[model samples]
Target: MDFMPIFCDLKEKLCLVVGGGQIASHKAELLSRAQARLTIVAPTFNHRLLELGKNANVSLVQEAFSEHWLTGCWLVIAATDDPVINQSIYHCATQRQIFCNVVDDPLQTSFITPALIDHSPIIIALSTGGNAPTLSGLLRQEIESHLSTASLDPLSTLATLAGSLRQRVKNYFPAVHIKHQFWLKFFTDKMLINAVEHHDTLAINVHIQRLLTESGAVSLNENRSN
Candidate 1:
């Protein structure tokens, strides 16, 4: 892969945007959603950007782009209309060892933002290495549609429940292989599937407990044999 895909936890991290237009606003909004402390620097800004600046986590600097703005920033987006300014921002960020994205100029960017599908605890990101954003968006739509029409419960709900039961599963299984086996069976079990489909948390918990009990007994027997 040309670009390694990874999700970042930007909660309270500093991020800088070097424009106040629509594209810059969009990038700022995404960072804000990630709970980043966002600072936008621009001589002029559009209405959307002005509105986003009202948020507690976002700050707007009505001044020309400068290298000083990049100080302590974990990520930077160069969204200025001027190519020279954007290039300068990218170079400055590079010197600071920060990941910088030059909007619409992937070749100059250290990172490219992917189209995201947020299902809360289950986010899916689609990217084309910044080669074809439109195609990436289309693929994302198709996947979202498929997920919505899937026979099973919403993946987010299933993921949330799985997270809540993770500690319990670990405590019950102890052995890594045994824990993996329990999850594999839990996901594929007909009883669990039926309960998830109907949103019956009680039934789901009961099924999980039964599976844990069975697996624990097997594990105990295996240990005794060993």
Candidate 2:
């Protein structure tokens, strides 16, 4: 039951999805969003899937999946409703040691797809170990509301500020405890909330300035202690 958790970089990587139904299409859409170069294999495609292929950056192989189809793919998803077809895909992927997720069939999968909420640089994934996908999905939706658009802006601005501060005050390393404490407060402070809530660039900028001043103080104290 032990499994390794890792995120795959699918951008420009070969990915295969063996189905054209709604579940198959859903998996394909997620892969496409990750910039994966996808090839979908199915005897037929739904109307929406066909339209999506026409404009989307993907390939369509219209035929039943053969054992050879698993060749050269970085990851594969067996989302077809047919258990027989899914079993074939699982065995093929297992033989090749390629990661594969078979929807609703945990025992046959090498990986599990979690419910994800993506806000560009910020991604939250929820997993129920393939027990209740619907519940996980609902939980993800609930968690999404708490992460406001503004919550991310301060973090982005903080990154830029941190880079400049690092260069401005070079050749000094604060004590690990002090450094950790300073950043913990900086990131989790009310200033971030205010910056996000008001959407005021000025407020966010001020928050960054305060954080820089605090870091400077900590650095000066550390030097004095030494």
Candidate 3:
């Protein structure tokens, strides 16, 4: 089967994990970091899981999984070592039309969570479609070495500022074509990339204006040449 790519926003959304073992604990940690309202259901939880749940403010349900436990969740994860239990959780989630993932059981899952690198405001996700998780993890490590803490803050700030500029452009122009050209010009400009890579906020701001001005100049030159 061909691999599919999906990106999700889980902020403040209710997410369920039907296990308390190491696998479930790992998933719970990622969900919590994504700001998902996480709920873990199992008869017992590991101490590490318990401590993380307490610290990261996740709800732990020390009970068996039931249909009632699957109510109103945006997404569900089945991470138990017990295949039968995981299958049950997957079935329940599917019956309710909610998104479900069965860890290490790709065929039974509606979605697969990728190996993630979270640099605040910048997120990188790597996946191998369940074919090779270890390989995926190794690739993630390689990617981490190339990314630094210094790059994210500036990149995110520039992205936000770019959005603000696009919004202002839309308010004035109100044309999809013009808005698209603005984005194309914004992204293709070398100065924007240079400024962001070097974490130069002032240079980024200056380059943004220069790019816009240069785009306008080119447009006018084309009109006159015609």
Candidate 4:
């Protein structure tokens, strides 16, 4: 992969958007969803952005872009139509060691935003290293459709349960390979699968406890034999 995939924690972090157009607005909205504090600079903003500015987390500045705006920003997006302004923003951000994305111009961007499927606690991201965004977006849509119709528990709910069970599993199976084997069996267990498909929390818990008990007994017997 040309670019490494990673998720950023932008909660309460300062982010700068240097434009007032739809693309800029979209980027700002994504940041706001991550709870980032935003400072948007543009001489004139479209209606959508103006509405977004009403949010307490967003601060809109009606002015031209300036290097001074980069101060304390964890990330910056250059969405202005003017190539000169975008280049300037990129250079300034580079100088300050800040991550910068110049809209659709990947050549000028230090980072590229991927198309995301946010199923909270189970987010999925797709990217083409900024080479083929349309293809990436199409694939994301198809995967999202499949996920919605799949005969499985909600991904977020499943992930949450797995997270809650992690410590218990670790405690039960101290060896890495044993823990891995236990999870593999647990997920594929017919009883657990049926419980998950029906969203039966009580059944799921009981199934887990029964499996743990059986596995623990087997481990103890193996140790006695050894």
Candidate 5:
């Protein structure tokens, strides 16, 4: 089956996982990182899951899985070693129109989770549509080695300012082509890279001003004010 990839915002959303072993613990940890309101259902939990629950502050049910548990979940995972129970969980979640992923059973799952490189506000997910998860994990580690906090955080901050900068451009330049050109040059200019590399907001602003000056589309009113 073909799967189109998407990144979900699980913050404050309910997520239910049916299992408590290592695999389930791993999935729960990832969901917790996204700040999901997580519930783990199993007769017992692995030591790691207990630790994760304490840290992520998630709900733990020391009982068998039940259909009622599917009631309000925005997302579901069935990672149990019991095939019958996992299948049942998948059916219940699917019947409820909720997305569910069954561990090691891609055909039974509605979605597949990918190995991710999260430089939050800039996440890169690698997947082979459940065909090659091992390879994806290897690539994720390889990519992680190349990324640093200093490099990613500054660009993420700059990305936050992009919306306001776009609005300013729209208000200042009425010509569509010139506005597009200005942004193109702004990105290509070495100073924009320097500003981002150095985390220099002031330098970024100066580049924006440079865009207006070089675009040659500044209004006559602005020229008169000058």
Candidate 6:
């Protein structure tokens, strides 16, 4: 817990990446995936970086690093091979209170990137707290292999359904214990799981309605509370 794992909403937020090599490109791609408005400051960029810049919200500053680039940036990544430049970037960013990551140099980083699995609405992040990134990647691969398509479908749908039912859930289950029981059933009920597994939207709706209207369900909730 030395490093607090957190997800950021970098959408449209200004992010500066200093360097243009392969590692820099990889970091830039991750930032792009988060929809960060990225500005890359480097004299040269690798081919992948150029390709990514084509479609991504990325700008290229074909010049040497400048401390002025740190102004107004939400975060920064120092991926340059030159330790001097990377250290300069790290110090400047930290002085400005902007979080920074110096690639391969965790001691200089305010944050570390974790191995991620992007299953659309379902995203999993793995980290070794900047101790072993390779281990995190291996763990992510193993976990990804065990995640079946059926499981992903239900989880994604469950997230969506929860959002759609947010207000209804509050209105229908005013009692805190009753609301907890209702959600507990969403995971434990075999019938609901089967409907989600089969991708039967109609059956899912029927099950949800039954859960709401059935007297037995309310009694079960009361029993759980007691």
How accurate locally, in lDDT, is each candidate? Answer: 0.89, 0.80, 0.82, 0.88, 0.86, 0.88
**In candidate 3, residue 158 scores what lDDT?**
61
lDDT comparing candidate 3 with the true structure: 0.82
- Please write out the lDDT profile of model 5 over residues 1-226, one tens digit for every residue: 3998888889899999999899999999989998999999999999999998786559999999999999889999999999999999999999999999999988899999999887766789998888889999999999888888877776676566665688887887787876777777766677776887776878988976876787764454545677
TM for every model, in the order presented, reads 0.89, 0.80, 0.80, 0.87, 0.81, 0.87
What's model 1's lDDT at 67?
A: 88
Candidate number with greatest lDDT: 1
| Candidate 2 stretches greater than 4 Å from native | 142-175, 191-206
Which portions of model 1 show Cα errors greater than 4 Å?
Answer: 149-153, 193-199
Q: Which residue window of length 10 is worst by lDDT in model 4?
A: 149-158
Q: Top model by TM-score, which number?
A: 1
RMSD of each: 2.1, 3.5, 3.2, 2.3, 4.1, 2.7
TM value for model 5: 0.81
Candidate ranking under lDDT, highest first, comes to: 1, 4, 6, 5, 3, 2
lDDT-best of 1 and 3: 1
Clash count list over all predictions: 0, 0, 0, 0, 0, 0
For candidate 5, give the lDDT of residue 108.
95
**Model 6 Cα lDDT, one tens digit per residue, 21-77:** 999999999999899999998999999988887865899989999999988899999
lDDT of 1 at 198: 85
Off by over 4 Å in 3: 1-3, 55-57, 148-153, 171-204, 220-226
Q: Which one wins by TM-score: 2 or 3?
A: 3
Where's the lowest-lDDT run of ten residues in candidate 5?
216-225
Q: Which pairs clash inside model 5?
A: none
How are the candidates ranked when ordered by TM-score, highest leading? Answer: 1, 6, 4, 5, 3, 2
lDDT of 3 by residue, 23-139 (tens): 888889888887898889999999868897785558989998998978889999998889998999999999999989999988899988888887645678899898788999999
TM-score of 1: 0.89
Q: List the residue pairs that clash in candidate 6.
A: none
Across 55-164, the per-residue lDDT of candidate 1 in tens digits comes to 99999999999888888999999999999999999999999999999999989999999998877777889999999999999999998788774542445566787899
